[model samples]
Target: MAGGNFMHRVLSYVINEVVVNGLANSPAFQRFAVRTSKTLEDISVKASKKRQELAEQIKEASRNFDSFKN
Candidate 1:
């Protein structure tokens, strides 16, 4: 039973080391990270623009309402 447990621990260690090193050196992972960052930046810009447009529209609507009341 002890030998079996030792072998299991060794196998687990090797598998974890291989996976961690492989991911750390992967170009595909780097590209994905960059692409995700750019996409988030683009989305943020669009959201900012839309927010500004909505604010302008609300201001214009308020002005129109004030003119109508007068």
Candidate 2:
């Protein structure tokens, strides 16, 4: 049973390596990775801008509230 388990592990490792290498060398995968990264970067930029805008609005609202209290 030990030997059988060892063989299974070895086979699994080899198969995983083959799949990883194949995907790494694939052009389609490379393009997909680049596109995904670019999309994520764009989304990050947009979210940052929105967060800043929200912060500015909050500050403005706070100033307005303080003026009314005085």
lDDT of 2 by residue, 1-70 (tens): 9999999999999999999999999999999999999999999999999999999999999999999999
Best by TM-score: 2
lDDT of each: 0.97, 0.99
Could you estimate the TM-score for every candidate?
A: 0.68, 0.85
* True lDDT of residue 12, candidate 2: 100
What is candidate 2's CA lDDT for residue 14? 100
Candidate 1, residues 1-70, lDDT tens digits: the string is 9999999999999999999899789999889888999999999999999999999999999999999999
Q: After superposition, how far is residue 3 of candidate 1 from its true place, in Å?
A: 19
